[model samples]
Target: MSSTTMEASAALDGFHPITRQWFTEAFPEPTRAQTLAWPAIAAGRSTLLLAPTGSGKTLAAFLVAIDRIMFGLPEPTLSENKPGVRVLYISPLKALGVDVERNLRAPLAGVRAVAQREGVPFHEPQVGVRSGDTPAAERTRLNRQPPEILITTPESLYLILTSRSRDILRDVDTVIVDEIHSLVATKRGTHLFLSLERLERLRREDDPQRRPLQRIGLSATQRPLDEVARLLGGAEADANPEQPVRPRPVEIVEAGRSKQIAVTIEVPVEDMTQLAQPVVTGSAAGAPQPASIWPAIHPRLVELIRGHRSTMIFVNSRRLAERLAAAINELAEEELALAHHGSIAKDTRLVIEDRLKLGQLPAIVATSSMELGIDMGAVDLVVQIEAPPSIASGLQR
Candidate 1:
């Protein structure tokens, strides 16, 4: 390898002896998205990684942040609190906020273990999640200890941007918005972009280097590449705040190439009219057919799950997710099936997520909650209860 290639390899190969080994062992080859995305991000550029559902986009964004932490965080005294937050991860869902930590466990642990063996103090990427579900005590404690990598929802991020402890984020150099397609077209995205600008303002106020925040957006679907790129990189600062706003530019990495997508839409093998009928009745039919129609398909759902090592059964809404999940739980009593939706209690949802990742559960009946690329290990199958709202949503799921 040339000198420059060797240097880039060393930097991107985890930036530490332990991390490099972890990368080699865990992923022998970088996915297309990671291959193109990492160098741009590491070079302090904003990027939008548009890849297929399981293309390792999350790792592409996270590994660079992890590298910075492993090699850059200052060593602190035992009594001192960890350093200021430098990477803020914004997930549209609260469930996903905590899921990022689970997704991060291996690289962080592996690299840290290697450092410990070599007597190096690795401290940069202490991660924490803050959301509505985050307890007051936990929130207070995190603010005091200030994790360098913070995973939070847009709402929680707004609170952080406006709260007294906002300074905890003043040093943040990177902001990762996962599942950007879910938010980019809505008011949530608007609020989030404003929050991004606010985050920029906070950093500009105190950072000695005065560097702009490096943004990495992971998306399943997006159109008009330049617009999405501009959206990824928020409005630029004005020499005068009242002047016309200029937006930052971004490098769009399109990894939506030919890949092996094995999707089979299955229906009942026989005696299926009952499964098609809406089981719940408030009107001619209670809610949508699929939500109310789950009873008839309960057997089939269970059978499909039994056939696969791990299955993510996608439904449309929280209501349907809960109802079908409950019915599936009863039908597949022997199988460890769990309900996952926005309405489910946070603790229960978290437990289900962990179970799915560990392969302890065969199936999880979920709504759009499972749509985002929050690692659940290798899912063998995906069964959507009904058609998704749009082609984009379907592609994402």
Candidate 2:
């Protein structure tokens, strides 16, 4: 092998043979983010990884944790004494959390397949999700026999810490917070930080000598990296009375530069004033209703959907999403689109997401609910009906 090839392979040396084999076969090579992050994470550093969407940033954060659970442990199988949760993944959005849970299945199964083929013992780690959407029975089951990895949201984590579920988190050594940018600037961010501090106290109360939690934060869009780093690494007071408190140490990995975006602006009417023209109909004589701009917009959306393999339409509200989706399907003369927003049932939204991923649906009209890091497989076109809520929100789309 060439020197460069040898160097790249060295990065995977810390992982188990089964993990390394499965990864090599699954992906051509480690992404830039993964190459830079695995070493720091394996060395047990709290790290904040910045990378663009679809750059394998999620796998960079997850693969090592999975390896540790499978191979680094003294026993391959979970014993009665070692059954507590070991890794905690926190996502800001419920859809993103659910997407992550579905995505993890591939890697877990890949590694397990490698082990079985080689006649090696494989310990399949269980994963559990706890959120408002989780059924009561499922929550009780999770509490009784906690999974090795727990995926949750900020509010759910706070609730877990406050209730009896907190016990399941006592042995958690690693916390992976996805989409860190969304949570660093608002009251929600403040609440999550407070919860992190509380979790630290809970861990220490369980075992005072245990090492501090290892936090790994992932974000595709952020500014003034230092500020986000400071938040990721919470504050600690110095021993000296006069000195100000300092933030904990956190390693920053920069890779995956944002792709240059192309924009096009189109309008249905030649003159802006034409949009306000009143609709005249034979049956409606009581009042003159302004004409709808949607009639003009729906056809263009259908045309775009036909042109692209997959398209995502972002609107400002749920009502618009539903209307736009139905209009597009009617205009296309087929069920070519689906609406995804907070108001939709969780199971229904999941089915829509699956259909889009499988290329069964050509388009999905969504609101801020799809603005986070949910993986939309093969979606190459994004149409924004109105301006996004903010610049960060737009970038997420």
TM-scores of the candidates in the order shown:
0.83, 0.91
lDDT of 2 by residue, 137-197 (tens): 9999998999989999999999999998888888788899999999899899999988988
* lDDT winner: 2
> Model 2 clash pairs?
none
Q: State the lDDT of candidate 1 residue by residue for 173-276, as single tens digits.
A: 88999888888788999899989988888777744347678899988787766787788898765578799887787888887777677887666545555556
**Stretches of candidate 1 exceeding 4 Å from the true structure:** 1-18, 73-82, 119-121, 206-209, 237-244, 265-295, 329-336
Model 2 has an lDDT value of: 0.87
Q: What C-alpha lDDT, on a 0 to 100 scale, does residue 69 get in candidate 1?
A: 75
177: Cα error in model 1, Å: 0.9
Q: Can you give the lDDT of residue 305 in candidate 1?
A: 82
Taking every candidate in turn, the Cα RMSD to the unseen true structure, in Å, is 4.9, 2.9
lDDT of 1: 0.79
Tell me the deviation in Å of residue 271 in model 1. Answer: 12
